[model samples]
Target chain A: MAGYPQNPSGYNYGAPPPSQQYYSAPYGVAPPPYGQHQQLPYTHVASPYGAPSPSPSYGAPSSSPFAALLPSTFPPGTDPNVIACFQMADLDGSGAIDDNELQRSLSAYNQSFSIRTVRLLMYLFTNTNTRKIGPKEFTQVFYSLQNWRGNFEKFDRDRSGRIDASELREALLSLGFSVSPFVLDLLVLKFDKTGGMNKAIEYDHFIECCLIVKGLTEKFKEKDTTYSGYATFSYEAFMLTVLPLLIA
Target chain B: MAGYPQNPSGYNYGAPPPSQQYYSAPYGVAPPPYGQHQQLPYTHVASPYGAPSPSPSYGAPSSSPFAALLPSTFPPGTDPNVIACFQMADLDGSGAIDDNELQRSLSAYNQSFSIRTVRLLMYLFTNTNTRKIGPKEFTQVFYSLQNWRGNFEKFDRDRSGRIDASELREALLSLGFSVSPFVLDLLVLKFDKTGGMNKAIEYDHFIECCLIVKGLTEKFKEKDTTYSGYATFSYEAFMLTVLPLLIA
Candidate 1:
């Protein structure tokens, strides 16, 4: 918990305070680094960012990192987006998603997500989808996980729960990250990884990847930022990085 | 073992005795029961009254009473026939089949099978498709189960692994069967629901449904036919009677 950034509102670590509301902006504009991002005009969506989110009043109220990342037109609970993902997950549409389905969804989204990873997740959520889910519907897994953990103890491999340079490396590798020399070095020194190969951070590795990516998100927020009992996060970055972790 | 019809040759139930290889006269004009009464060509399939079978093989090694009632083409492992079923069951063409699949296949073949019945059968063979089932596969789940005391003791509610009149009735009702008196009486008297619902019998019910009513493959064979120990079968009657039990 000490590594967590401070958030007065007590929402997700590194996340913005609850007061900030994103007005709908255009989507697909410059898009992200991937393929061409769609450009959505305010006319296409309902009040853009003003659209209702899936979660209730946000409880104590905290803006989403993903919603914060995309333009306002991209509302939090976009029906069409969810529908497509569900279709991918429920190939036969038998009212529930199964292991093969989750695998298909993962492959559809990121070729990197292996069948093993999807299978593990499926076992974790087997028979739970009495209600149908699309590949996108799986987002709940990641979002809930990150928002829920709030600290590194659970995922940290070395048991120290703190991300050191080498520990972060192994953890990232397990999660399907490509470690470049400079990127590894940056993450290493900053992440406090140097513990050893046998030791590694678990979920913290994933969180580290998402939150502190810099211009992308708040990289190194855990270390550089003071411990406010919560990790600091940017809306835009969390959505792209952390949120995608849950998708099949 | 009293019920286990002695499979002397061990040719799945009473498949042709691999050794003796008795020969028989081919067919002349068979009766209207197997032919004029069905969707497919009537040939080697054994008729209820021992109508002259088309195949040179006499008796056609019928497994159950209901078997006598099916079209000849639906014998064990028929190519085009099973291929159609596979298409239906393997919804995604990923090579494996699951529950809802067998359900649709049975329903399409006859009026007897229902969704609940299909689910029970699918669940019985839950893991078989993954492993290449052969000699060991033969007795492991099937014959071996006849002696199974553990599973029967487990799912058995009132210390009776076997469901009796009241238990079967309740089981059917729970599975979603209305338990019509005519069917209820018929079930109590014949289907031996009185015995414990051990995994073997469960497998038996599934195999019987697929081989008899649904016009699917007939790989499941009786141990033997003679008093020595062979399973009696009914390939003709629709399995809707069992659907209630499955739902329950």
Candidate 2:
């Protein structure tokens, strides 16, 4: 409750008008507010390397950065839409994508995630044994990306397409995380593209930061079974548990 | 503080007498109270399968369950005493021990850890990629086992060679884990070998149970960075995070 939005109505920044009957429809099948397959103006930075790029053309032929790297066909049972999204990311056509490919894919979506973020994503969703992010893992990652995008828009109340430190805190709070000021500063420092001038997080970095925090927190919870704030660990256990997430 | 021992003086159940200055000495080099290698009376069960066994002979030629399995020599810089201990556990001389070997080794120390506990140990200290527990990993584990053994002895207030539910609660509390009644009961049910009649945890089982709790808690703390007692995780992240520790 402490992290809940203070004004519920004010929180619905991007909610469709009550007249839009399909606003509440299931994801992946809902029609866009704009015309189907209509490309929006790419206002956001499309690459972490400071490049302007074309927006993604959903429900259309693949024109992603990695389009040339996609396989001709996807594995059985992969949803057609999901296969389309996966192809945009699976840059090597191995039916899997690594961190570099994922970065390019996100850039194609006009979301500029850092290499570190994509590595963390690979660490989280890829097969641990093979370090591969196949179509199934891609689907989950895409869904989370969209979910985080929605939350980001909702929290970016000014429609500036970015959230400053305070807005970021509110966003995390709404997501059930009440971080300390120290941790908040750390998050902002880690994700803020403004070089500490504005302490702001862009749409892509917000998703990256949130996923990192969530993944790390979930890993920690596995050890804190009694919900005790304190936990004991051998030196090796401590290193093994933390180093992978930070260094992966 | 809720978990702190009620009577501080009473908590030192197995402390050496005041005349014994080396009681506070560093581990691995200190002489045992009985003798440098005196075999203590084998009072506790040595095997999970109810097999009575000979006590381990320290500071002497190896006659352990896995003595025939030890390598002729150890890796360089391995502490002589530590090597002695490792040899006792490194059954099959692969220079590395798996969960089964670890279980046998703990049993040699008169500590009958369950295969599950040893598996968790491997999961925690072994090389994550190789899943192998080598000498270095074994050293850390051995140290932790000794530490836990000390704590277990301190909390076994009745000196009945086992701690009941109340004593276990005190043990965990002193170790900074104030588990809820439900968690405490669950722990007792899982670790208590008396089939839930007396709800007592033996020395070895206590060590195993405590390690499991500690490892899991440490892992959870990674994700709960905000310390909000809550975390958000994607479905795959949740499964990947929790499943290995539970099933490994």
Candidate 3:
């Protein structure tokens, strides 16, 4: 409530403390501070004296002032290396990368993705304005990518450099996907091309699986064109209607 | 960048504009304003002028300013209805409800959940201090329930008061669960006791499935003790080890 004691009975309500209420207005814009000396992290220790080049690439030396202050990896601050990656990926020179462009570029780096998955990836990784991922959004992408890679490696418990079916399921589960064991098997079978049942999911396969599952769920819903809150599927009907999509 | 224009080359950067750089200290605390007249929505009309009773309950008239401001429903904002529910459910009067208490209360509302599922629900629904959920969290619970209910109704396309297999799949997908068809079928089969393949899932069953899928994923992960990213199970093994847990 507006006037209740901010803290009552040892509960810390979300409302700002009364002393700091003046500036904590809901949706109110706050000003910036420019008084502090710039601190460059090891990953962002590029020369600050160089002039901006005509075609600046990631990690390329540039004197954009902003480039010099980008932090390295850990804190995921504005790092020049990642900013350059974004700029390079913005192939249309629109100053913002749409989902398609980002996806294609990421695929080049072995992170293949379905469009919906890419959209989810965008939602998870970037802070977009009107779905347009600009430089600011790309900084978050760097951080998110670092996180995704870490998760991938950690879950690849066998150290096989690839996650097999069970591991992929765990990864999806941790990512908040409430997948079933049978579905997990189907996913691995669909994507895992190795001859034996021991087929595994590489990084690209893992990303693809995440997206395909999302896509298939929507596809399944579409079959319920009657809006009956229920749809009947016999064995023949499933083999005809759904099997191709999964294999495809 | 430390002092560059917030927007350059038509690209919006996250840095604050130079105009307000002095006041916008990074992570500076702001203050609140009390001068504005309260603009209560049609939903926030409260029955004021009532005195607080010794044992106040949700939606019950009370003199507490916060209670007076809580809304009945719709546009969920600090509604006393949910707060009262949380209070009524807080059996020990500890000023905070743990997962067990909340689960028991939710079960009374027909939203039964496993301990693991309840923990996930708590994570999704409340802001806790050392996992103790207080009134502030109950408000969030109201909001989350409202959201879940909305998602449920939306996917129950036929208005049949229940969701079928495909519909359930869509509902789960919308609920951020990338479920598989096989799993979807199993869920419906588990909940829809009225035999025949065209089983439907009511609200309670749907929530249970969401929790079950999550719980099962955790259980499956536990079986992968070797970190091999692969677990072996014969049909007999599955029947003995997994099916019973699911039915239970």
Candidate 4:
């Protein structure tokens, strides 16, 4: 898996802007409409990784009662800012990001969260006992979801919610990476699990693949500081450093 | 293990100064005297990863010869430049770097060679079939050997060829890192295979330990960009990123 930043600044610790702030929304209630995309009312002060903020007055009966950490104006629809963080935490690429990975990913952002605290957060956000949090469900956690939505809309030219190999190539190139065809082909084969060249890449897989490639390329460029087109590496070095970028 | 640069410039690729050059003295013979440190009379152009330059006129009976890549006059004895590269390749903390690691390490210097080529270089340098190459034996390869020797000598304060934990802590501090006592203890426990707290750290281990600590601390500082001094992480993140810096 890709590594996360191990500093507090990596996480946007700024207090939520007033427009996005709301009284702590009780868990599991149909979110009160905050116009446009219905955002869950979340309190800015509550820790993102901990139990939701307490709202004694607005006690909407919730099976898994916990304070909402994200604001009601949390811009809805997938956030791109969360993609790299999500991919780093989604170690296995199973599409179901678990509490362990989430907790670890948060740590990179300098968020201190106990596993129990993460479990509670997961329960509040997911509303079911299932340990895995799918991509659609994860969107409920924050306003940065707008970042993902915007990126996906920009890339999904056909509005199909999935981008194909050619589109993926174009998307990455637009992101300023000169990904070789061989590497692109390898990536498609590795991540396009459905095995058909005609298949469009799903949102989650596309995000994961893009993030991994970008991160690895950055690492390669670090060693190739002289701007050499290629960086020579022994098989072992390749295995230890580069392989993780490719295989994971 | 730490990573190495993959550019010639990354390896300090500038041509050697006139004072360090000498005629090809032929391999396996005592390197013609170059003042205090006997410098290897390597061809100015051989790849750092392969056989000594094949100067047919000099007839250096190389087991597996290759094109000259690095400059002929490799600087002599303990130059500080090679410490990070050597530490990166010394992955296992065995205090003995092997051919595989060396070759990959050279790749970061923009040199490419097959395993057979590395084996031949090792043979010419040590004249032994042993798999492990200690620091003294490894110095025979090139003038850059000066970097490693110089670094080791600088840190081996008592002239015993080993550095104690206090010396290591000081070395890291001088390198501009604020290493905590807890992290230092953990690092010593992880790398000190000899299992004695009173034991002084040998040259290779000291370099490796320092590199690992520096690398991890840098990663932490990246997250703590605000100079907050502390960054919190969940247990899992601690395991994936920070723990590897400590335990690996």
- The model with the greatest TM-score is 2
DockQ of each: 0.01, 0.02, 0.01, 0.03
Model 1 interface DockQ: 0.01
Better candidate by TM-score, 1 or 2: 2
Q: Quickly count the clashes in candidate 3.
A: 16
Better of 1 and 2 by lDDT: 2
Candidate 2 per-residue lDDT, tens place, B1-248, comes to 23325544333222222231212212122322344222211101111111111122221233456754764333345457877877777678778777777777677645566665677667766424234576656666666666567767887777889887667766664553434444555566656667668778788677666655555554554554444334444333443454355334
- The chain A TM-scores for the candidates, taken one by one, are 0.29, 0.65, 0.45, 0.40
Model 4 compared with the native: what TM-score? 0.26
- Of 2 and 4, the candidate ahead on DockQ is 4
* Candidate 2 C-alpha lDDT tens digits along A24-74: 212122322444222222111111111111122221223356744764333
Task: Give the CAPRI class of candidate 1.
Answer: incorrect
Candidate 3 residue lDDT tens string, A1-30: 221132232222122222311111111112
Clashes within 3 Å, all models in order: 58, 20, 16, 33
Better structure of 1 and 2 per DockQ: 2
**Candidate 2, which segments miss by more than 4 Å at Cα?**
A1-79, A127-131, B1-248
Cα lDDT of model 3 by residue, B12-53, tens digit: 212222231122111111211211233211101111101111
List candidate 4 segments past 4 Å from native: A1-149, A232-240, A243-248, B1-248
* Candidate 1 chain B, poorest ten consecutive residues by summed lDDT: B235-244
DockQ of 3: 0.01
Error of 3 at B99 (Å): 4.6
lDDT of 1 by residue, B1-248 (tens): 12213333211222322231122222222333323222221112232112122333323444467854543333333335334645555566655444555455445533345444444344333322122222112212232222222323444566633544344333332221222233333333333433324322332342332222211111111111222221222211111122112111
